[model samples]
Target: MDFFARSLAIAGLSVSLAACAGAPAQSRPAAVAQTAAAPPPMAPPGPCALRPSCDTPFPAPSKREFRHNRSGLLASALGPRHRGRDLFLLPGTPQWVLGKFAYGPADKDLKDEDIDVYLLRGCGAAWEKVGTYRTTEDEGSHPAVVGVADEGGQIFVNLAQVLPGGPLGVGRHRIKMVVAGDGTSVDLFLEVLPAGARIVVTDIDGTLTEKEEALVGDVLTGNHSQTHPGAVDVMRSLSGRGFFMFYLTARPHWLEPRTREWLRLRGFPPGIVHTSVTATGRMGGAAASFKSGELSLLKTATGLLPELAFGNMPSDVDAYWSSGIPRTFYYKLADDARGGVKHDDYRTLLPSLGELPAVCP
Candidate 1:
């Protein structure tokens, strides 16, 4: 079987992709190809370019948010119908917005679909409609991406290549990846971490939840997701002390929205959030591989590493240890078999945690 087919089988997407609690997403296809505007410079690959040092020409301000110009697609011409937010990163992270395209009831790849990316910076009264370009570079046929999307329906774009300026300014910047044919688009948020930021990494799911994360969906008892009694307070204390939060999860990418909502509903501090991109990335031992690799990528491009790490599973142990996180903590594991300092409650450790020197300047 091909890579995507194999991934689907491993993920069991054919039976469960629809059951996932969000907009219907086509099963991820194989890695899409990418290209930039000019000659490839000394830049990290699409997924790892975190140095915010390039740009495409900025588009003008727009009074209106993006919307599909027309909808009814499947006809003599099968066309793209949906878009999805792709990757997130620190500023200067040049990567394509993640997207997929399909047509018809079977959801076949809408090949040769040209995708355009537009940056929307909230202007005083209007959004500065940054230039809509093909690659993160400039407007042109992304020969490789178009070729891949033609075969696979991933309407992806590489990040800020030889755009035209310095990195995107830090803060919340909105980006839209649109089907050039129709206005069908995926709205995404791009955030740049504070320069020279110190990071604290924490796992979600079993680590933070007072009970199984599934309980957050308990419509019967109305039991919203609950964190450990002191979880929020402790995290807030750390945030107050100047460390940035980095939420890592092995959950499938489809759950990212629910994950974000849970974080906000529970009053967690704002920070970078990363969800596993594949089912294999999260299950069993791959969780550690995924998390460790992701942290390594962040450090490679951004030069920032976690000063403290928290996890609740053996996978987390492997992840933290392999990533070289100096200070680590895990929930219920006994003995030193799992590694890291054991902790029973966040409150009990508050004093010592607070005593640690502040991370932010």
Candidate 2:
């Protein structure tokens, strides 16, 4: 059988074993009891009698309130000193305004002369310039203001206030900030999230493995393709702490079973596995657009919003950034070859295996 088919078979076996292990035990009956006989069957009711009138009132809307903190942590081990905020928006709500852009010290060193924020929705071909604000100096504590300005420091237009509108929908939204100074610009995107959902999506290849190249040579054929140190323990701890975990990859669907089995063997829990459509081609890194689309679809199917994401590639960052989810924990192999110990964002790194925190509020 091909790799995918074999993997499916293995998954089936594992599922069967899991089912058996979960079967409920039977209870013993009481000793010696006298029983009575049953009565004969009666005639069926007439059609008119069977069709009894019943008025079912519409159920009242649920009153339970959904509450969650709107704050989140931003950690980057890459040393650039990342800073950002987490805004909580209602699912399906229309894009809300982020108010105004305040130029910071970083803006002073810009090669470009102006800064702009763009709204990228639905990972498609176009992005809308919803609002644009500029700063007088590259560095300052200027008061907040709205509207667009020209290169000569003249106000061109006043943009509308950032307001929220849209039906109840949920998922991540990415906001890209472009700072143009001198003759260059840098694009920094941050994710926004809805409340209550706490899912974690991770890529499986280089981010979690030392094999920096081809999957066939590094993972499929080599015995060295094992889980990174501390990976399994962290995953187990997260699972125990009530965080839903999933593996999202551009890997072919045919590899699902083997990949699932590999993860199971490596101590990762059984969570949803997303693979690309066969027509999309083979095991390759998905485009940021493609991953963004998948993230939307997954959000709909699972009814859970991911609060944090983890991965190592630029594309992964792009995808997560666009989805609008808050909190991203990125990692790279330590430069000194001290294994995976050294990391860029160690503040939010998983606690050591035995030191995992309790899940209680």
Candidate 3:
């Protein structure tokens, strides 16, 4: 399907704004919506005398490094069941960036960099300074090296923790990141999804996309990324119904942008997309370790277990089962030795949604 048509089919031109307390109006799909007043101005970040403070140290990165920079902002979709009178938990969210510097014929060790973070209230609203943070330089994956090596390395800049702050006004918030060495920047949105009793986790490769013989160069090159006919639609339908959808993939971090772009081009609903920093290739046991580790981290951060999980490979079966989600609700797109009821494809299984209860009993 063409990009525009797929978008229309999955997310019709009309938007339905479901009420989510403190969630920004823009975060919802669309419908008649009310806007909440902006929160009172918070104090800006402290000024730094040095050109590169903890937040923005690397102010003049080379062009080669800038082109390959990557930044990510994420917030836990799950929040506390009850807010106590004494403790206020800032939503568990993080702002981070990954990039290289001073490109040359051969990669060299990188010095630590700095980044600045600002929180956006809304469109045209003044952005408030959150804080300045520093990156930890490390060697990233390279063709010449099996493990982390100094050559052709990348650096990681993370906020470390969500710094203490005043209560934020109810609404979606945007995080803006600026590279200190160069004037490069990226922005990401954070919103606390409405409370839902059930969460759904799905695998990307063989389950949503066409069952591939292998998922190496084909995926990285955008050559083998056709989605199943109804997979995108079903995921959208679930998201609209308030299910907290999370896309769990073992695709290496470098492939993240491409994977997300592919999903958007195919009209899949937006959700939290998790990936690994390294690859053991498709269906490797290390992938099971990565997936399960991610699931464990998700549970620890969000305090919610996914009620439903989906996958197509044996690694997926082991990962989901080990994460404490039931094998019954764990639907498989194809058969494996692990043994779960398998669906021929999403088209046949989507109808079963009507039979399932909305809230976990």
- lDDT, candidates in the order shown: 0.54, 0.38, 0.45
Candidate 3 segments whose C-alpha is farther than 4 A from its true place: 1-110, 120-129, 138-176, 183-197, 213-224, 279-282, 327-339, 355-361
Q: Comparing 2 and 3 by lDDT, which wins? A: 3
Model 2 lDDT tens row, 223-290: 22565666654555555554555677665433433454455455564344554433122232344566
lDDT agreement of model 2 with the native: 0.38
lDDT of 3: 0.45
Model 2 stretches astray by more than 4 angstroms: 1-197, 218-224, 279-285, 333-348, 352-361
Top candidate (TM-score): 1
Per-candidate RMSD vs. true structure? 11.1, 24.5, 15.9
Cα displacement (angstroms), candidate 2, residue 113, comes to 64
Q: Of 1 and 2, which scores higher on TM-score? A: 1
Best by the lDDT measure: 1
Q: Write the residue-wise lDDT of candidate 3 on 1-361 in tens digits.
A: 1121123222221221122333442233221111222222322211211011112222332322222233211111111110000000124443333333221111122235455666554222455666655544544432321112333333333332453554343333445555554434443444343344356788887677775432343432224356777777566556545555677777644344445445555656555556554422234577788778777766664577777787767777888878878642333434453545576557776676634544421
